[model samples]
Target: MKPYLMIALCCGLYAGLVAAVEPITVAWRDKAPYHYRENGIEQGFLLRRAKHIFALAEVPAVFVERPSKRIWRDFERGKSSYCSIGWYRLAERERIAQFSVPFHVDPPHMLLVSPGARATVQAHKGVATLLQDGRISVGVVDGVSYGPALDRLIAGSANQVERVTVAPASLMQMVAANRMDYMFADEADWEYLRRHEEGLDAIVEQRFADMPAGLERYIVCSKDVPAQVMTRINRAIGALSDAAPGD
Candidate 1:
């Protein structure tokens, strides 16, 4: 090959090598509008913002997806380099992961009950009161953190609540099937399910006013991520011009 052609080929190879550098494996759960399928593409407030932050960090990335509990399990077991999008800054999570500053404060997880069960939930004063009353079984996803206060409430009433490891879709299916009395869901997840789930129309909504706020989400990564990279990610997050609104 000519000298110029040789130089061009070398540059192309270098570019490819850089682009192919091991990406931070981002673990995503199928929960919207934080992370979910839309028109067969991944799109959500958190996912979109995460993409921009990752790009600004100038790192290659790949996504691995699973149900909520498994997402955390896989991330812990090395199935993914880290996880991006929609992690509430719970104490347990902070212990194991490096989390970016708040990307957004999401709607507090609310009481989602079936239409017929509406009377049952409403009969109680609030979530804590209802759980303490124990007239009904509350459904919750296994690994999800319902903020600090709600976690305490659920922990206090573990017998009254059922914890299952399933995808958001299946969780709604359970409620629709009346297999579980109710589950704690955010507004975004409920809205997404409303469009796709057949029986989600029967799901009723209520507030947890007693639950404390600061249900903010952050980009959480495994311990192995380089300090510099995390710093860059944090910086990128801070500089984002279009942050998703907080609750």
Candidate 2:
């Protein structure tokens, strides 16, 4: 059993002159319409896109499921071979994880409140105004990013918001229950939640008057992942985009 023998055997298993690509463990938390498990099947827009890209690139992927916090932690370590399907290229996240090209582009983040809370929220220009007024109790998830403007506002005035250390879906439930005055969610996530959550009719959508929406989401891989794999994934993404118009 020498070096050449191992390569020869692996190529035989793969057939032709194909070289075995290292498996990338692509993990994601349950964020519906983007990433979630339905009937024990991994499904969502980004998940499907990632799977397709990997397949087209001839890259083997091992997908894992986790809560938001663990996904953040694992993606930071760079020792575990875990990558995520959809994550923003926040200045903070970019420091720890190497990101692939964009696969999904979402609309700006908006505020969601119970209908009763609407009068108060509407009085203000935006989340920044509400925070400046120090009157409303905005609910936000602990590990998620709400883009730059809101992040700066909320961080500066921490007491003005209630932090929910739970899933995004629960954040909406809290708003509906009057436990949280409101929460921040992008259009896609809010759309998915509002349809399924109880008492969601009470939720209100607030377009951000404060800041513009940011960049598209990148397939976030731990920095430990090989550069070549990311390149292959990006190329596959481009291929899919190229093929879409004629289909």
Kindly report which residue stretches of model 1 are placed more than 4 angstroms away from their true locations once superposed. Answer: 1-22, 38-40, 64-83, 241-247
Model 1, span 71-123: residue lDDT tens: 67765675436665678777666677778777777666776786668887788
| lDDT tens digits by residue: candidate 2, 89-160 | 788888888888887777777778776778987887765667665667888888677766667777886446
Ten residues in sequence with the least summed lDDT for candidate 2: 15-24
Q: Against the hidden true structure, what lDDT does model 1 obtain?
A: 0.75
In the predicted model 2, the residue pairs found to clash are none
RMSD per model, one decimal: 5.4, 4.0
Error at 160, model 1, angstroms:
2.7
Over all chains combined, what TM-score does candidate 1 have? 0.76
TM-score of each: 0.76, 0.83
lDDT score of residue 79 within candidate 2: 53
Question: Judged by lDDT, which candidate is best?
Answer: 2
